[model samples]
Target: MPKKKKITPKQETALRCLQQNFDKRAELAPSSDDVHATISKSSPVDIDVDADELEKNIATLSINNGNTRIRYILCLDIEATFDGDKSFSHETHEVIELPCILADIKEGKIIDEFHTFVKPSLHPQLTNECIALTGITQVDVDNAPTFREAIQLLDGFMKKHSDKLHPPPQIGSPPPNGWPNLGPRNYVWVTDGHADIERFLCLRSCRINRVRLPAYISGGYIDMKLLFKTHFKERGFRRLPDMLAKWGLSFEGREHSGLQDARQVARIMLFMVQMEAVQLKCNRSIVMEMNLSFAARQL
Candidate 1:
């Protein structure tokens, strides 16, 4: 047998942290009822879906992925304002709601969540069509944070979980499976589609607000839609509800509501990993090349 590799001090610390977290998962894991209650209390609108049904579906879909390499997944979704039917452009629209769920892939549970509504700088007033579609009222945006402030808060949230979010470097070669050993960097961002990062976060919001996009946010992401199509050998992009239906699961909360949508995406991810044994990886990315000196001058 090959000699065992020695763990460095840094790796030892990370291992200790992981062990402690796992030990406390029993205390940290919230019951399905508690989760539903929390969402209901936090959301502005009432959810009409049956809580028992939703819990049952989640329980049915939750399966252990013994082959999963990653430790965590960050499921993200955004709701934005738009023009009725004229056209679609990231530049024209604005992100109105930002939400994300952090999940422990092996345990198949959402450990934490973050959410906020963003007030549009350009289009301060909500279009009637946008209101009807997203169910976000003018009053909601009025009380929300600006895009810059929202991004800052998001960055802080990521920092708060830095150990999990940014894993330490691996000291040796990757495993024989041809997949890189992610070391402490053991998480990937998951989204229903690419628009959340490519169009909204990187292109529109950061540019309009004159904020430098966080490196982690732009690094890369797993496009769940693409993964589903590839893994199941399906064609074309499907909506979140449709995707959930594939697993006999109904969406739990208000459609298009950022937090609800994010949670649903997390559920789909769990199903894919647990039921289908899909290995999650970054399927899409955006290349952001910025001239820091010039950018600093402009700022």
Candidate 2:
């Protein structure tokens, strides 16, 4: 095994602050209703915690601040080929773009990114609708690696950042039963919705490409849309742009561009954590059976 990487002093301070806040929050509140109160009092800032400006300021804090303790959130968003129809099946679609933003939990900013365009074996040609919606051209996919190759590159990126990750389970240990049973993980994947992981990666891409979905990916992920809805107690938003509009923020780039979407999702997640003190956790996981069928569990 490789030696663990050393964390910077700033990172150490941020991790300590986060651990203290989480511990205090757990001690102060036994119910969800009192969480905000606990967070407000436990915040490192000495101002009105409810103020939006304060929350934004907290987001910029780099050195101030998990079991199953998260050090990073891997924000991923995929753009796939579509016929411009809502009734399309996952079986018929193929991921054309893969992008990820690795956000440091304590720093509240993206520390790194991984991106690639995937050439689909099933549908090598992009439909006009898909091209228009995603702005991904045929040349992009033609010049890109295959799904398997792209995933291999992604795995390498994750390994490069392994020092920031939580230790994996022992080789002989029983597979994780649930969130509580699972030991500490340094990071968790976050997506705008379950489709990216559930329908795209697990159900479609892996099966189509004869690739085994990495355990790190299939283990679980956070559905950011669901988290936001539950946290704000509002269900009015239907898409990422809508979510941004609610916060008086506009989408920064092309709507369906994978990297841009992932960045926006990271932004929203940071805002929720720094401003609202919402604890991010894995809310979804895949259960793979002997027969290879997948059952997505909502945790």
Candidate 3:
């Protein structure tokens, strides 16, 4: 049997371009409702035969430059309350039972989220006060998957999304079977504070043998607690909440709901990206306008 050769980087890029062209072709087809609606938005005289030609031109441009290299961020936050007695005791330490939320953010908006409750194997019992504050009890953790399961699920989700980022195959060519050419993608998990990471590391009984999650997730994390202190020193910014308010946005929602908090964090980061893109576009337009004005002055 002959060994199949691996796809070179140039060939991989070509495959992506071909797939994008296929998507463009499908969009311009007559039966496509999306194509029809986009055509209706323009004037009748400018429509007709030019639409297909325009689509082909756009396809060429798309193939030449695709946004597949865009970064994807995994935002996460955890909510936990101290379990056991009301008073701090030397004999017993407050057991922290928590739920963690994970979200996938790209181009500044959160596209997917996962919420999971971690079963505190070491601290199985919960105090009444803790239950009231966190709304979590022994019953909740009884059947819930352990922290290890949650990590496995998270890893699987990342792999799935990495696969999804591929541009569809080009038209008229048989669909690139199950495996479309794959590429290296980034994964950065952000947490509200370092406590969540700390807690996971402290769990002695929990399954820690399989994967070293922290090392893999160290790429980019927007730690609000760390950012607040660093911002003041470097950028003269006061606090995260203050910065968010200045940007005309406010963070709201239940504090301990991991999913809700992760979503809010994703939204804030996405807003920053959107504003920067808009600013860049405006600056370009202003430069063009200034050049045109100077030309008119010469006339």
Top of the candidates by lDDT? 2
Q: Is candidate 1 or 2 superior in lDDT? A: 2
Error of 1 at 252 (Å): 1.1
Global CA lDDT computed for model 3: 0.38
User: What is the lDDT ranking, best to worst?
Assistant: 2, 1, 3
Greater lDDT among 2 and 3 belongs to 2
Candidate 3 on 189-264: residue-level lDDT in tens? 4455554443433223222322223213322234544543343344443333444553444545554555555655
* 1-299 per-residue lDDT for model 1 (tens digits): 12223555664454445435433532453433332222221112111221112111211111123343577888889988788866775556788988878888787667887777788988899899889988889988897777766765566557658777544321111123322323224677788878787677656766666554544444446788888888867776688878877755567679988777888888778767766668766666543333211111000
Q: Poorest 10 consecutive residues of model 3 by lDDT?
A: 280-289
Clashes of each: 2, 5, 1
In TM-score terms, which candidate is top? 2
Task: Report residue 232 deviation for candidate 1 (angstroms).
Answer: 0.6
**Best first by TM-score, ranked:** 2, 1, 3
The superposed Cα distance between candidate 1 and the true structure at residue 168, in angstroms, equals 7.2
Candidate 1 residue 264 Cα shift, in angstroms, is 0.5
Q: Write the per-residue lDDT of candidate 2 for residues 1-299, one digit (tens) a residue.
A: 12223555664555455445433432432221221122221112111122122112221111111224567888999998877777876666888888877878677666777778888988899988889989999998997777766766666667668778664421111233422233346677889888887788767776777665554565556889888789767756558777655545567678888977887888777756765568877777654332335667677
Better by TM-score, candidate 3 or 1: 1
